[model samples]
Target: MELKKPSDNCFTEVDGFGVAICNYAGDQNHLAILYKNPQKPDDVKLFHVNSYKSDLLTPVESHYLWVDIDWLPPIRKIAITANLKNIIDNNKDTKIRYGFSFNLGCFDPVTGKINNFYDSADGFTCATFVLEVLKSLGVELVDWNSWPVASPEDINFKQYILSQLESYSVKYPDIVTEEFLLGQKNKINDPRFKPQEVIAATKCKEASTYNSIQKPAQLVHEEVLSYSN
Candidate 1:
């Protein structure tokens, strides 16, 4: 059974992959992922992007991000909101890099490696990056956008998503359009995250789709792992 949702359509988990939600504003930002195990539960250290200029808001969820320091047991949701909107966006002339933040002392029980997805794409993979991260982390998926986004005359979210597909690198822009970004600010909102039968059924009929998309990421990750080793 799915766990109780801490917020509207938002579920929380500490052991397996936790659901992730996003909130982006003029200067404030929030990204949350849920997982039960903190690797070193007793002592935790989390590093995040210094570009963050605001105060890392404690997540509404019982558990949240960053390392917890301060003589505590239940890990405090840490954050990187220093330069957030406070300082200017530094590091110009740079394309996208992985992690885009500090290094956390998270570890993978299997490989004994730090549980950091940073070297990937600022801890994001596809435009469905947030969704994929939660899934990859082992959290189950739930439909978050069940409610219709438009009226009969209004534009459908599906089409909006297709139109926002200019950048293959990001995957789904509809997930980030003004509406989604705005909904994040409200205390009460829902992300009807559900499994898309159509997308998952096909074994990639479009041969180049996988090669063009997943290949680059796979190759990049392999290279990083090898270099680190």
Candidate 2:
């Protein structure tokens, strides 16, 4: 496989609550969404996209797919799952589960522009779809399949990525310092190199105003930004 990194455009500032993972190598790319069930996170449902047009996230093309979290106002938090079956020997000898959690508002589905998903406070969550571009950056295909069927707390990808990001920022502060992008790169390319710069990129938190909503808000209020940003 060709060692590559994600395009620079993928790391730009984004403004949507949705995500799209692109696979330029083959046609086996897949998308998955974590549907939040009120405050009960353990009960969240994960649905794999089958019908692009009618599904939560639409596939603009085989290499790109997206979804609007706003479409599901009831969803408190959403996790983007990247199916690395094609890139990695994505199969399980035993049923293992692992994933991380991030604030859902980090992505804006209504606007397709890029945004920073890192906050340096919340730590690493499942920003899978956003980091899919790392394949080209020489990130090993094996790393992508690290997700096991376990709770977010049980997963260690977040801490592993944080250390990577902190180091990359020290050497390359001029460019985008988001961990999901840069961390994955360094972790794969130079795992042994200890970075001098401290990694500050962390996860963001979702707003609490909607915590009491009984039904999906018809129209998301502009003031929602009070907490989202």
Score each candidate by Cα lDDT.
0.27, 0.27
Encode model 1's per-residue lDDT on 86-178: one tens digit a residue: 111231222222211212223233432334542322222112333343223222232323333334322343233333332422564543344
Runs of candidate 2 exceeding 4 Å displacement: 1-103, 106-110, 114-155, 176-229
My TM-score estimates for the predictions, one after another, are 0.23, 0.22
Give me the candidate number with maximum TM-score: 1
Residues 1-229 of candidate 2 have per-residue lDDT tens digits of: 0111113323111222233333322212333332233343333233232321122322233223233333322222222212222111221121111123222233323332223553322222223322322222122112222223433432243455455545655776543245434434333422110000000001112221222221222111111211123
Clashes of each: 30, 27
**Residue 212 local lDDT, model 2:** 26
